[model samples]
Target: MNVHFKYEKNIQIEHLETLYNDVQWYAYTQDLAVLQTAITQSLDVLTAWDGEELVGLVRVVGDGLTILYIQDILILNAYQNQGIATQLMQQILEKYHHIRQKVLLTEEAADVRHFYEKNGFTSCDQGSLVAFAQVR
Candidate 1:
């Protein structure tokens, strides 16, 4: 498993579809065009590739100065528990260390909470902060 990371946004639709679907994130796979546009327009994108196969991704959206929102971070099911996601998180954090307001929203799950907590993130309720989202 010689996985390497890249900060490239010009990814192919097939690769995006395969990786998103592999992680069971069907919503993004539903619209390949929109997904591609989203990636290209992101503040930053870090992708893990095994040879030519994209196995992991972490993307951010923000002005790159004051706030950063982790729009998505995922790894293929077969590639989980290998620290790829953590590395992705680390790289992004290091890149935006100066940003004061880093945020992300994910489904409520034990593992999800643990992962974010392990990555030095605290839940909204844990602090004096509350988050709201409008999903469709």
Candidate 2:
């Protein structure tokens, strides 16, 4: 399959919602607010398209120069197993290659861990640290 990859910094918010809903791992309907915040404040976002359809996406949110938190690496179910996620991560990594400060929270899924590890991320030592936030 010739999957064409179209890269963009600011993708339509609606397209992102659609892609989020299409992915199996995320709770789409319940995550709209979180997703919106990510889109609106993201330091960078990359969307993958097979022609006019969005197949995969990933975003990084943080201070543009120093710290970056990778958020929402998602690909539609039908598009899984293809190299789309890998390609998306590769592109994001390239964009941040010169920057040394970056981190991402990943689900504990074994495959997901493998993917991140393949991309050069290692498990962090924040074992006793806790993250908290109040949702509006």
How far in Å is the alpha carbon of 132 misplaced in model 1? 0.7
lDDT of 2: 0.75
Look at candidate 2 and give me any clashing residue pairs. none
What lDDT score goes with residue 39 in model 2?
A: 72
lDDT of each: 0.96, 0.75
Q: List the residue pairs that clash in candidate 1.
A: none
- Model 1, range 1-136, lDDT digits (tens) per residue? 9999999899999999999999889999899999999999999999999999999999999999999999999998889999999999999999999999999999999999999999999999899999999999
| Candidate 1 stretches greater than 4 Å from native | none
> Model 1 compared with the native: what TM-score?
0.98
lDDT of 2 by residue, 16-87 (tens): 777877775456547777667657677877877877777787878877677778877888888898888899
Q: Provide the TM-score for each candidate, comma-separated.
A: 0.98, 0.78
